[model samples]
Structure formats: C-alpha cells, structure tokens
Target: MSHPIYLTKSDLKTARSCTTKLYYKKLGYPTVDRVDGYTRILADGNFIVSKIAHLLYPDGIYISANLKTEESLINAAQETIAYLQQDNVILFEPVLYHNHKLARADILVKQGDRTEIIEIRAKGFDSKAHEDLIRYRKLSYFRNKRTGKVGGEWRYIIEDVAYQVGILQEMLAQHLPDLQIEIAPYLLVPDRAKTTSIDNLASYFQIQRLSTHRNSFSKFNGIAVNFTGDVQEIEKDQFLTKVSIETEVAELIEPTLTSAQKYLDYLIEQSSEIFAPISKGCKSCEYRASDRDDRDGFRQCWGDLADVEPHVLDLYQMGRIGGHETPLVNEMILQGKASMFDVPLEVLDDDTYSYRQLIQIEYTQKNKEWVSEQLPTILKQIEYPIHFIDFETSRMVIPYRAGMQTYEQVAFQWSCHTIAEPEAPAIQTEWLDLENTFPNFQFAESLMEVLGDRGTILTWATHENSVLRDIYYQMQVYGYHNPQLQTWLANTAKLGTKGKSNLVDMNALTLKHYFHPLMKGRTSLKCVLPAIWKTNPYLHEIPDFQQYYREVDGEILSPYDVLPQLQIGDRIQVVNEGAGAMLAYQDLMFGENRNLGIDNQAMRSQWEELLYQYCRLDTMAMVIIWKHWQKLCAEVL
Candidate 1:
C-alpha cells in the first residue's frame, strides 16, 4: 500500500530532527531499506508497558483496530468517534484529527465538559529532570542549542501532549461547542521509584514484526493472547504518575505545535527539495540504500546532494557542544558548514565530548593520528601480563529468574585476552552462561579466577567496572557472601569514590593517548575495529584472529556476519548483536511452546555459541587495539 501522507505525532516529533525524513517517510521507502528487528522489539516493549499501564484504568476502552492498513485508520477514527459520542468515556488509543494531521492519544479521560489528554510512554522519567528540562528548554526551544527537533526528552513528550491537546481542543470547539471546556495535558511514564517485583518484567510480552504501516499500534495488535504469566502487581499510582503541571507548560505546547505544523507544511510542499545537510544527528540514522530504490533517504541527503564523504557527523560525540543542551555540528551544518574541515581552528581542552569532537575534527582535517606526549610514560606505567577483558551483556524488559528485576544487569558472558609476558603469544579465554541461571556472581567468580591478583586488567570502558560493582551490590542485597569476590572487587574495582582500581580503562587510553584518521570521531568498538582491521595487516596474519577476517567482494566483514540464522516459524530471525541475543534469550527461556516447533535446546545452543563469538570478538578487539597502541608506543620510545 502507498504510505499515507497525513502528518502524525511521529512525523511531528521526527520533523524536529530532519524535515527531509518527513518527505521520504510520506513518499515511502522500499521494504528492503527497512530493518524491523531492533526497533520492532522496542515498539513491542512500549506497547507492553502501555498495556500494563492501561491496567491502572480498568474501565478504559482500547479503541482496537489492525492499524496496519488503510482500513484500520478508518476504523480507528470511527471507533474514537463512537466512544466520544458517549458521556464520561475513558478511551485508550483514541484517534484525533486536525486538518491534515492525525494522532492516537494514548489515553483520554473525558467527563461531560472536561477532557484530559495523557500519553503513556514506556520510557522512564525523573520528575526533577523533566521539570528542569521544561524550565530550561522552553527558553532554548528556539535558541542556539535546540535539537532541530523539539529537543530534550521531557520537552518532546510534553510537546507531543501539547500537540494532541491542540488538535482535540480545536476539534472539540466545533464538535461539542456548548460543553464548558477544560483541557488538561499529561504524560504517564514509569515511576523512577518503582522496582520490578519479578526478575524479568520486560520478558512477559514477546513482540512480533512491526506492521508495515506507518502510524499504527501494530505491536499491540492481538498481542494480549501471546503474553504468558503475570508480573507482580505494581501499585498503579506508584508505578505510573501523571505529570505535574508545576510549571507553565500549556503556553509552551501551543507555540511548539504551531512551529511543528508550519515546518510540516513547508516540508510537504518542498518534499525532496528540502536540502538536509549531513549533520551529527545522521550518526544514528536507520535509513539505508535499497534494492528497487538505490538512493535511500540517507544516501540522497548525504551522498547525492551533500557531496561530502566521511563527513563531520562521523566525529565522536560530535552531536553535543560543551553542554549537552545544543547540538554542535548540526547547528554549524544548518549555518552552511558541512565538513569537520569547516570547523575553525580552536583550543580543545579536557574530557567533555565537545573537546574530543574538536580534537577529532582538527586531526581529521590534518589527516594524521594524534598521539599525546604522555603515551610513552603511560605505556611504561602499565604492569605486564595485561589482561584485556570485554563483556557481552543483555538486560531486557523481562527478568528471567528470581531475585532479578526488570532490565537488571545480567553479565552472561565475558572474554579475556591474556598477554603473560612481552614475547609470549596472546592466549584467549572466555565464559558464557545462558544456562537459564543467574550468572552475575558466577561471571564475577570466573573473571576473578582468570584475572587472579592481576597485573593491570584492562577494559575498553567503565562499563565492565560498573557491571562488577553492580554484582558486588547484588551479592550484598542477596545475602550471598563471597569474601573472595568482595575483596577482589574492592582491590581491583573502583567502588564509588574509593578503592584503588587495578583495572585500567582502555577507552580513557584512546581518548588521552591515541587517535586514528580512520576512527573519524568515534571511540566505539563498532568504528574502532573496522578502522584498525582495515589498516593493520598484522591482524590478517594472526591465527587467533584469522577466523574474523573474510573479504567479501574486496570489502572485509566482521565474524558477526557468520553467525547461525534462526528459523522461528516461517521467518529467518537475524541474530545481529546484543539486542537480538537478549530477545533470543528471552524467547528460549519464556517463549517456549512445543507446538510452535522453535527447538528450545537448539536455539539456546545457537545463542550460546553466538554470544561466545561476539564476546570473544569484543575482547580480541581490545587486544588488537592494544597491539596497535603498543606498536606506536614502541616506535616513540
């Protein structure tokens, strides 16, 4: 079906980012251009949370429809009207319209004369954060730091509600002119104070593929039957709360929505004419080149028109300025600057991502790797038998076992590359636990056994250290005492503000000691591995790393491509990374049904092996990066 041209809340929300996307979205991109796996999981999660939140209002009507086809849009609108015709109806997913705009209000509480609009989002919130965002952002919503989209999390949420309120307010004026009008807008979000009574609160509802439809609740379509078991009953008020109107929010909403509509109209008229330059926001763009349509949204904006390659957006943490409020490079791009080369020469001081960004941009323009003067001294300080450790973890909405809470850190896997001496071969060892058991303590214990009272344990980032600390806290809370684990954690791990950390953060090393031209501005393993792998032929010759290299049509690919394809029913599920692995783990543990023919044992075995390789790649990736650093350090010495 041809994609509908009507502007919805999503389009309204997204147009704040890039108006050009609205054009591609309205015109429709090919099915090949879309990858439904990762986002579909998130959509399902949102739906499940919404459903659970709906339990708070027992009398609330769902206004159900397929929502995947044109038929559903018509039906949903009709269903909403039918519900609205009655007095005092609490409706969920009510369809509202304003001119060419459409929105599915999450929940609407209507009295004889007063109506309240509440949007229930699965995204968590802190009240102070929300309040501060609203207070600060309404002032800057149009200023220099504004994310082209209505920026800030709470700002966007409130903007959405404000948008809905604007539409409903306009419609009600005509539809029920005599009713004494009172309109209130709210956002219902997961309470920060609420803790999941069950281990896997997010696991209960399994998500299906997103409906090919654009503005639809396809995730919840007939999903109620698929959910098994029940989460511990959360106190409705405790779990979810109406956003307090402690500040003046109503004024902010109307102005934002007006701007949203103005932009929407302009973009619609401009269509593909909207020249969206390659900006920092492009870093997370999902649009890809397609089969039927070769020039996808990203390529059209970046490749075809921008005439820029390996652009400024590629710079690490290039999105934000010194403060996270304003998007740095995008604002620059909007002002006609397109490349990192366009950034003026400047002093880059300290650890703020902005400083890192400026440093990267300068280096990229110079076309040289920037090695700090402290490299030799830093390298010398490192104790030998350096253990390079990397962890692969999954924290899903559902907890799998007892004593686990929703989205709790479960360290299911770890890989360590040990260099015992200067000339000795790098020995690789790893551990993975998908044994339908809680592996946090076991993971810590295994890591300790391998690490011993180590000489310099290295991790790419603070993530590993944070995971270990969480394990220590869990040990304390679970009342499972292991003095050995606790002592090792105290000695080796950086606990809070104290503890002498034997572990060195390799990411800090990268930030302080190294930069490669190919790294652009990224410090992530995703960018780092490819940058190092493509440049250093030493990796191609190493037996331990040989399996990872496979030249496909003259372009090398990571071993992630070689993992087993999962056949669930008629669909071949791609196990791409951690998100996919988490879904697979949840399916194997909780989604088992003998009649469905998803071989529980086979699937578990497949995921176990895949997780091992992915984790091993992570650790080995650290080793490869270290090797590169070592080479440069040796040369300097």
Candidate 2:
C-alpha cells in the first residue's frame, strides 16, 4: 500500500527555481544545501522576529507539528481543520491539505466569511521606496517599477503566498462546500521605517538546536525557542508591519497552482522528462556535487560539457560580457560553447572584453601569472609601520537596544598586523567584545588606539572603510561623545570631499593590476591567497608564517584549509568565514538557552578564542599577500 505523496510549499518553490531539481530532490540526491531551515532562522535572527510576531498576535490556537513524520503532519492538518469550524478564531501554523497538496500559513484568522492568510518572512521591506510593490490593481506586486521585470526575491515571496492560498481554496471547497470564504493574503516582514522603543528586545528570544542522528530527516530534530526576559516589555514596541498582497496573490494563484500541479505529476510518476536548460545559473546549483560523486545532477544534465576545465563560466564576470539583461553565457550555451578554450577569439578581440578578462583569458591559456608593469610602482607608495587590518561585523535583523534602527551594523571584532619597517616582524594586536553591552563605540575606540595617527591602513575591500563610516554616522545618531574616535573615523572612514580617507582597498588593487591563473575570475582574498601561497615557495621558510603550513598525506594544504578547530563538547567546529563569525557572535550573546554543559562564562571564553584565531588569520593572510607582492616587485627591480 502506497501512502499519498503530499506536495509542500518548499517543494513548489524548488520546482519553480529549477524543474530538474525536483527530480534530484525527490530521489534523495546529494546536495551542498545541507543547512536546515532551523539553522538559517537562528543565523538570520528571524527566530526573534517570529517570537515577536507570536507576541503581537497574543490569542491563537496553535497547531503543533515537528514535521518529522507524516503522522504528525496529518494530525496537525486535522487539528487546523477542526479549529477552522469555529465562528471567530485565530490559528498559528494552520495546515490546509487537499489532493495531496498542502501548506501551513504562519498565522490564519477566521471571522464569519473572511479568512486572513499571513506569511512571515525575514526579508526587509521599505514602505517609502516600495510603496508601489503592493499596489491593489497590479498584475504582480513583484514587478520592479523601473525594469518592468519581476524582481527575483519579490517574485519568490509572492509565489509562496499564492501556492498556500491555492491549497487553502482547494481545501475549503472540499471540506466545507457550503461555507463561503473571502481569502486575503498578507506578508508580515520587518519594516525598516519603524523603530523599536524597547532596549535589548533581541536579547529576549533565544535559540536552541536539539541533537539528532546524521541520517535524520533534518540536521537537528528541531529548534526550540526560549524567552530570557519579560514579554510585556516587547509588547510596548511595534517593529513589524503587515502589508496586504491580496490582489497580487489573486493574479498568481491560478498560475502557481498550474505549475505546482505539473511538479506534483512529475513527483507522482517519478518522471525525468522535465527539461531545465543549462545556463549561467547552473554554476550556482546546490545539487551539483562538490567532489567526485554520482548524484551530481548538474553533471547529469551537462555531461561532457560539465567536465571542461577552465570552463566558459570561469571567465571573469562572464555575465557582464553581453550586459546583465541578456548574458553572453546563455548565448554560448545555446551555441554549444562550454569549454573556456572553445571561446571564439573574435569575442575576445571585441572591445567589450575588459582588460581584466583579457588577462584572465591570456594567462589562463598560457598557464602562467601576469604582473602588471604598474604594480611595482603602486607597491612603492606605502610608508613604514604598514597596518594590515580586518574587521568582523554583523547586521542583525533586529537591533539589540532602543534608539537603534532594524538591521543596524554591529562591529564586534577587529585584528591588526603592523610592520614598523621593511623586513621587520609583523606585530599582532586584536580586540573582541563578548560582554552584554553595545560594542560599536568601544570597538572603534580600541581600533583607533592600535592604528593611531600614522602609517597607511590597508583592508581587503571597501568593507573596513564602510564599517568605520557606518560607525561615524552611528556616533552622531547615538550621541556618542568621543572626540579622538570621531576625528580618526572622519580621516580614515569617510569618503569623497567631506573627509581625507587614507584606507586603501587591496581588492581594488588586485582588480586593476593583479591576475593569477590559479585565481580564475575571482579577486577575493581567499582566492588570491592560495594562488600566491602555492606558487611562491619563499613564504614557506618564514618562521612566523610556518604555523599556517602543514603536510597531511604528503600533500601541503592552504592556510585556510588548516584553520584551528574549537571543540564544544561533542562537536568540533571551525570559524573561518564571515558568516561563521556572525553565528559565533550570536552564540556568545544568546547561547544561555543552549545546554552545552559548560557554564556561560566558559562558553563565552571558548567562543572568543575561536573567533580570535579566525580573525587573526584574516589579517595574517593580508600580510602574506603584501609580502608576496613586495618580493615580486623587488625581483622586477
């Protein structure tokens, strides 16, 4: 006996993106998108947003479901149906199912013949800029007013609501044929226009991830929400806004239902006839295997074309070749031009090919690196006591304190490596704040002390300048009284004629003058580091730099590949990337809810140590790149 194949809202979204993925997903193919919804919610600070939403709508009949088993879903759907029978009621996560198609609304309200279907999203909405997005009489709320094309994210959101509304309509028709209903769709999103009047509102809600087996339905069994402080305090502020997308949902409901039905049919019959054409977008497909694996759906689609090394997709900003509206890669793919070697010489000869792109193509074909004649001249401009600095910051969906706007920048950690003179050992200095207080002012103040009013400050991208600039303006907004810090920020952070910003972007330097065959089309610090680290053998001999080098199975690894791991009870984790640092910061702040056996203070210290190593390596990586460039310039001289 076969159980009915229930189609979910997530399933519809996946199908809409790529029909081929539907086949890959249903058959349990390997994928890189292993981060579960629960984890994503915690990382984005949406868990707090959801809790606040629940608080806003205080009265509701909650339909509980772990969504781990079919039985649980059935019970939840049954419970929701029973609640909908009431004359006037509010239901949370109310499930509606008919014809093996189902959806669970974030919140549902029923009054007489009217029912409101609310979908909660973590995306930010600007009322002033996006007023026309949800205008009543439009074909879609998702269309960009200027472009006349449907916006990608907005389209996805509208379609998600439409998918749920279609199911609800079907369910009501089947279950309660005599009851007339008026369906209204609304999107509940964080409003940037509104401010929270309560301090530490984000601190109230905490996240807890439960332990689960590796082969379980989800990475964790489920996420548990815990409130640390009083809920009445949060009730005082209105931070979220609900906008009616009723007309947009009405226009999309039928189309979404049709597409969902086709996807459902493919799932039911286990069909492979659905053809999603290979294009530039296929490069980012999560279903594509990282290593040699059979379940590489991308390879399964592209076949021999996917095996092409230095592929056409490897060309630097290939999409920008024919312009963004219509990418040249799409044209190449249509003409069966897959390999990078197969690119027409006439195309490269064309004036549209950027000098960076030409360098990439030329050196990539020659199997060598290209050093611009101007690089040495640019390298000679820096003075002694050169500072290579890096920042680790996060923008939270909800602000930690009052008088702070939503998605405000929080600069929590910094690392600086200073060299007093040529050939001198780089001095390491860093600052990290784990205390339960606003850290931006302290962060800027400490950074100013280390940097002082001398030497050139070098950062990977415009990120450091941007972070400091944000802090500069935030100082004025928050009325932070710090004369030295303000003056330093004005000189180092502010751009244009208003201030003399000395911060130089190394990434910009790389873009204009540097090209490594190993780096392919990217100029990111991580990409450029490995390219130079592998090619330049002299770096391996430095005593201070030797810590990053290691041999495993007779193979030398990149410094990033050999990053230190921190053991948190049973789990061994590494914080190497910016996103990982953000999560670590969040854990330090709100991890009291998690039962890790270690006390709060111990956990804080461990997290701080882990973050310090990662950030220290970042500045260290920059220093390595600088040394490599100096050596190259010296050799040329």
Best by lDDT: 2
List the candidates' TM-scores in order: 0.80, 0.91
Q: Which pairs clash in the backbone of model 2?
A: none
For residues 1-637, write the lDDT of model 1, one tens digit per residue: 1344466777776677777666667667543425354664555556666777676677888775655555556666767766766779998888876555677788888887667787777666555555555587753221225443434566766677777777777666766566565777776765444454554444455444433444354335534424554534533224455674313356566686687677666654664445566666676765656666765667666654255655666656555443456556766666766666665445234355555676677677687767787887887788888899987676654444544444567887788899998857788889877556677999999999999995889998788888888888889877878998898887777778865667798888888678888887667776777777877777788887787788879877755664456664456665656566555555554444212345455655655565566677677788877777777778877
Residue-level lDDT tens digits of model 2 in 453-529: 88899999888988899999889988999988888898888654575569888999998888889899899998999
Local distance difference test values of all predictions, in order: 0.67, 0.78
How far off is residue 19 in model 2, in Å? 1.2
Lowest-lDDT window of 10 residues in candidate 1? 139-148
Candidate 2 wrongly placed segments (more than 4 Å) = 1-4, 36-44, 66-75, 128-143, 147-152, 213-221, 290-294, 323-328, 331-337, 349-353, 496-500, 592-600
